[model samples]
Target: MEEKPFLGLRTVIYAAPDLSATKAWYAKALAIEPYFDEPFYVGFNVGGYELGLIPDASIVEGSTVSYWGVADIDKVIQRFLNLGASIHTDIQDVGDGIKTASIKDPFGNVVGLIENPHFSL
Candidate 1:
Protein backbone atom coordinates (compact mmCIF):
# COMPACT_ATOMS: atom_id res chain seq x y z
CA MET A 1 0.00 0.00 0.00
CA GLU A 2 1.15 3.48 -0.82
CA GLU A 3 0.95 6.31 1.71
CA LYS A 4 -0.95 9.33 0.57
CA PRO A 5 1.05 12.51 0.40
CA PHE A 6 -1.87 14.77 1.36
CA LEU A 7 -2.75 15.19 4.98
CA GLY A 8 -6.01 17.07 5.76
CA LEU A 9 -7.53 20.53 6.05
CA ARG A 10 -5.26 22.80 8.05
CA THR A 11 -5.91 26.53 7.77
CA VAL A 12 -8.10 29.01 5.89
CA ILE A 13 -6.64 32.49 5.61
CA TYR A 14 -8.77 35.58 4.95
CA ALA A 15 -7.66 39.06 3.98
CA ALA A 16 -8.41 41.57 6.67
CA PRO A 17 -7.92 45.15 5.55
CA ASP A 18 -8.79 46.33 9.03
CA LEU A 19 -7.16 43.73 11.22
CA SER A 20 -8.50 45.03 14.53
CA ALA A 21 -12.14 45.19 13.39
CA THR A 22 -12.02 41.92 11.50
CA LYS A 23 -10.40 40.16 14.43
CA ALA A 24 -13.10 41.44 16.77
CA TRP A 25 -15.87 40.28 14.45
CA TYR A 26 -14.43 36.76 14.20
CA ALA A 27 -13.96 36.58 17.95
CA LYS A 28 -17.67 37.30 18.44
CA ALA A 29 -18.81 35.02 15.63
CA LEU A 30 -16.66 32.08 16.73
CA ALA A 31 -17.21 32.82 20.41
CA ILE A 32 -13.47 32.60 21.06
CA GLU A 33 -10.36 34.71 20.86
CA PRO A 34 -7.57 33.95 18.45
CA TYR A 35 -4.92 31.61 19.87
CA PHE A 36 -2.26 33.41 17.88
CA ASP A 37 -2.40 37.19 17.49
CA GLU A 38 0.00 39.65 15.86
CA PRO A 39 -0.03 42.83 13.85
CA PHE A 40 0.67 40.93 10.64
CA TYR A 41 -1.53 37.87 11.26
CA VAL A 42 -4.19 36.43 13.50
CA GLY A 43 -5.09 32.75 13.88
CA PHE A 44 -8.12 31.27 15.58
CA ASN A 45 -8.38 27.63 16.57
CA VAL A 46 -11.74 26.45 15.38
CA GLY A 47 -12.33 22.92 16.66
CA GLY A 48 -8.64 22.17 16.20
CA TYR A 49 -8.55 23.76 12.75
CA GLU A 50 -6.83 27.03 11.96
CA LEU A 51 -8.78 30.05 10.72
CA GLY A 52 -6.16 32.64 9.91
CA LEU A 53 -6.47 36.31 9.06
CA ILE A 54 -3.83 38.46 7.41
CA PRO A 55 -3.54 42.18 6.85
CA ASP A 56 -4.19 43.13 3.25
CA ALA A 57 -5.75 46.11 1.53
CA SER A 58 -6.96 44.17 -1.49
CA ILE A 59 -9.85 41.98 -0.38
CA VAL A 60 -12.44 40.14 -2.37
CA GLU A 61 -14.90 37.33 -1.66
CA GLY A 62 -13.54 34.76 -4.06
CA SER A 63 -15.24 31.68 -5.46
CA THR A 64 -13.33 29.18 -3.34
CA VAL A 65 -15.17 27.98 -0.26
CA SER A 66 -13.67 26.10 2.69
CA TYR A 67 -16.45 24.48 4.72
CA TRP A 68 -15.99 23.97 8.41
CA GLY A 69 -17.75 21.09 10.12
CA VAL A 70 -20.72 21.92 12.30
CA ALA A 71 -23.22 19.92 14.29
CA ASP A 72 -26.18 22.23 13.65
CA ILE A 73 -26.15 24.04 10.33
CA ASP A 74 -29.18 26.26 10.92
CA LYS A 75 -28.05 27.41 14.33
CA VAL A 76 -24.57 28.20 13.17
CA ILE A 77 -25.82 30.04 10.11
CA GLN A 78 -28.20 32.11 12.18
CA ARG A 79 -25.45 32.97 14.62
CA PHE A 80 -23.21 34.07 11.81
CA LEU A 81 -25.99 36.14 10.27
CA ASN A 82 -26.51 37.92 13.57
CA LEU A 83 -22.83 38.72 13.63
CA GLY A 84 -23.05 40.59 10.25
CA ALA A 85 -22.30 37.68 7.91
CA SER A 86 -24.54 37.84 4.88
CA ILE A 87 -25.61 34.61 3.23
CA HIS A 88 -23.32 33.63 0.41
CA THR A 89 -25.13 30.32 -0.07
CA ASP A 90 -28.29 29.08 1.53
CA ILE A 91 -28.32 25.77 3.34
CA GLN A 92 -28.91 22.83 1.07
CA ASP A 93 -29.15 19.10 1.58
CA VAL A 94 -26.29 17.63 -0.39
CA GLY A 95 -27.56 14.08 0.17
CA ASP A 96 -26.45 11.28 2.51
CA GLY A 97 -27.44 13.18 5.61
CA ILE A 98 -25.19 16.07 4.73
CA LYS A 99 -25.92 19.80 4.57
CA THR A 100 -23.79 22.79 3.58
CA ALA A 101 -23.89 26.59 3.52
CA SER A 102 -21.62 29.54 3.04
CA ILE A 103 -21.61 33.06 4.42
CA LYS A 104 -19.73 36.17 3.42
CA ASP A 105 -17.86 37.54 6.35
CA PRO A 106 -17.62 41.27 6.99
CA PHE A 107 -14.09 41.16 5.63
CA GLY A 108 -15.35 39.94 2.25
CA ASN A 109 -14.43 36.27 2.52
CA VAL A 110 -16.66 33.30 1.93
CA VAL A 111 -16.86 31.21 5.07
CA GLY A 112 -18.42 27.79 4.61
CA LEU A 113 -20.08 25.44 7.08
CA ILE A 114 -20.98 21.77 6.71
CA GLU A 115 -23.03 19.26 8.66
CA ASN A 116 -22.01 15.81 7.52
CA PRO A 117 -23.07 12.92 9.72
CA HIS A 118 -20.87 10.52 7.80
CA PHE A 119 -17.61 12.42 8.28
CA SER A 120 -15.42 11.14 11.10
CA LEU A 121 -11.97 12.10 12.29
Candidate 2:
Protein backbone atom coordinates (compact mmCIF):
# COMPACT_ATOMS: atom_id res chain seq x y z
CA MET A 1 0.00 0.00 0.00
CA GLU A 2 1.24 3.46 -0.87
CA GLU A 3 2.09 5.55 2.17
CA LYS A 4 -0.58 8.14 2.73
CA PRO A 5 1.73 11.07 3.23
CA PHE A 6 -0.10 13.82 5.07
CA LEU A 7 0.40 16.08 8.08
CA GLY A 8 -1.99 15.77 10.98
CA LEU A 9 -0.33 16.15 14.37
CA ARG A 10 -2.89 14.27 16.33
CA THR A 11 -1.18 13.81 19.67
CA VAL A 12 2.17 14.36 21.37
CA ILE A 13 3.77 13.70 24.74
CA TYR A 14 6.27 16.01 26.35
CA ALA A 15 8.50 14.76 29.13
CA ALA A 16 9.13 17.89 31.06
CA PRO A 17 11.48 18.07 33.99
CA ASP A 18 9.19 20.16 36.17
CA LEU A 19 5.52 19.39 35.80
CA SER A 20 4.30 22.53 37.48
CA ALA A 21 6.67 24.77 35.55
CA THR A 22 5.89 23.12 32.25
CA LYS A 23 2.17 23.27 32.81
CA ALA A 24 2.34 26.88 33.87
CA TRP A 25 4.57 27.76 30.92
CA TYR A 26 2.24 26.21 28.37
CA ALA A 27 -0.89 27.57 30.02
CA LYS A 28 0.54 31.05 30.01
CA ALA A 29 2.09 30.88 26.60
CA LEU A 30 -0.81 29.24 24.79
CA ALA A 31 -3.62 30.43 27.04
CA ILE A 32 -5.26 27.01 27.14
CA GLU A 33 -6.34 24.84 30.05
CA PRO A 34 -5.55 21.20 30.35
CA TYR A 35 -8.58 18.99 30.01
CA PHE A 36 -7.12 15.84 31.47
CA ASP A 37 -6.70 16.46 35.17
CA GLU A 38 -4.35 14.22 37.05
CA PRO A 39 -1.53 14.49 39.52
CA PHE A 40 1.09 12.87 37.31
CA TYR A 41 -0.17 13.38 33.76
CA VAL A 42 -1.14 16.75 32.33
CA GLY A 43 -3.19 16.75 29.18
CA PHE A 44 -3.71 20.00 27.32
CA ASN A 45 -6.63 20.10 24.96
CA VAL A 46 -5.69 22.33 22.09
CA GLY A 47 -7.22 22.68 18.65
CA GLY A 48 -8.47 19.23 17.70
CA TYR A 49 -5.96 17.17 19.64
CA GLU A 50 -4.40 16.91 23.05
CA LEU A 51 -0.82 17.45 24.13
CA GLY A 52 0.19 15.15 26.89
CA LEU A 53 2.77 16.62 29.23
CA ILE A 54 4.32 14.12 31.55
CA PRO A 55 7.26 14.93 33.77
CA ASP A 56 9.69 12.14 33.27
CA ALA A 57 13.37 12.69 33.82
CA SER A 58 13.92 9.57 31.75
CA ILE A 59 12.11 9.32 28.43
CA VAL A 60 13.71 8.09 25.24
CA GLU A 61 16.89 8.67 27.35
CA GLY A 62 16.25 11.86 29.28
CA SER A 63 15.13 13.72 26.18
CA THR A 64 12.14 16.07 26.33
CA VAL A 65 11.13 17.38 22.95
CA SER A 66 8.21 16.16 20.84
CA TYR A 67 7.05 17.53 17.53
CA TRP A 68 3.41 18.01 16.73
CA GLY A 69 2.96 17.64 12.94
CA VAL A 70 4.05 19.01 9.62
CA ALA A 71 2.44 19.55 6.25
CA ASP A 72 5.40 18.21 4.25
CA ILE A 73 7.04 15.48 6.26
CA ASP A 74 10.09 15.06 4.11
CA LYS A 75 10.59 18.77 3.72
CA VAL A 76 10.25 19.32 7.42
CA ILE A 77 12.70 16.56 8.11
CA GLN A 78 15.11 18.00 5.62
CA ARG A 79 14.85 21.40 7.21
CA PHE A 80 15.77 19.96 10.60
CA LEU A 81 18.51 17.78 9.13
CA ASN A 82 20.03 20.75 7.38
CA LEU A 83 20.08 22.62 10.64
CA GLY A 84 22.23 19.84 12.18
CA ALA A 85 19.41 17.68 13.47
CA SER A 86 20.77 14.14 13.62
CA ILE A 87 18.07 11.91 12.31
CA HIS A 88 17.57 8.98 14.64
CA THR A 89 15.21 7.16 12.29
CA ASP A 90 14.44 7.57 8.64
CA ILE A 91 10.93 8.18 7.48
CA GLN A 92 8.89 5.02 7.92
CA ASP A 93 5.38 4.14 6.80
CA VAL A 94 3.75 2.77 9.91
CA GLY A 95 0.35 2.13 8.28
CA ASP A 96 -3.11 3.60 8.22
CA GLY A 97 -2.13 6.89 6.66
CA ILE A 98 0.65 7.58 9.18
CA LYS A 99 4.25 8.34 8.41
CA THR A 100 6.84 9.27 11.03
CA ALA A 101 10.47 10.30 11.30
CA SER A 102 12.44 10.75 14.48
CA ILE A 103 15.45 12.95 15.04
CA LYS A 104 17.60 13.93 17.98
CA ASP A 105 17.73 17.61 18.57
CA PRO A 106 20.93 19.32 19.66
CA PHE A 107 19.73 18.98 23.21
CA GLY A 108 19.82 15.21 23.02
CA ASN A 109 16.04 14.99 22.80
CA VAL A 110 14.42 12.88 20.13
CA VAL A 111 11.65 14.78 18.43
CA GLY A 112 9.39 12.76 16.19
CA LEU A 113 7.91 14.50 13.19
CA ILE A 114 4.73 13.00 11.81
CA GLU A 115 2.73 13.54 8.63
CA ASN A 116 -0.62 11.90 8.12
CA PRO A 117 -1.77 12.53 4.59
CA HIS A 118 -4.70 10.17 4.19
CA PHE A 119 -6.88 10.76 7.21
CA SER A 120 -7.29 13.12 10.10
CA LEU A 121 -4.64 11.82 12.45
Best by TM-score: 1
Number of the predicted model whose lDDT against the real structure is largest: 1
lDDT of 1 by residue, 1-121 (tens): 9999879989888889899999999999999999999999999998889999988645434536889999999999999989899999999999999999999998778888999999888
How many pairs of residues collide in model 2?
4
Q: Rate the local accuracy (lDDT) of all candidates.
A: 0.90, 0.69
Model 2 Cα shift for residue 108 (angstroms): 0.7
Question: Which digits, one per residue and each the tens of the lDDT, describe model 2 over residues 68-102?
Answer: 56678888777666666688889898999788888
Q: What residue pairs clash in candidate 1, if any at all?
A: none
lDDT of 2: 0.69
TM-scores for all candidates: the values are 0.91, 0.46
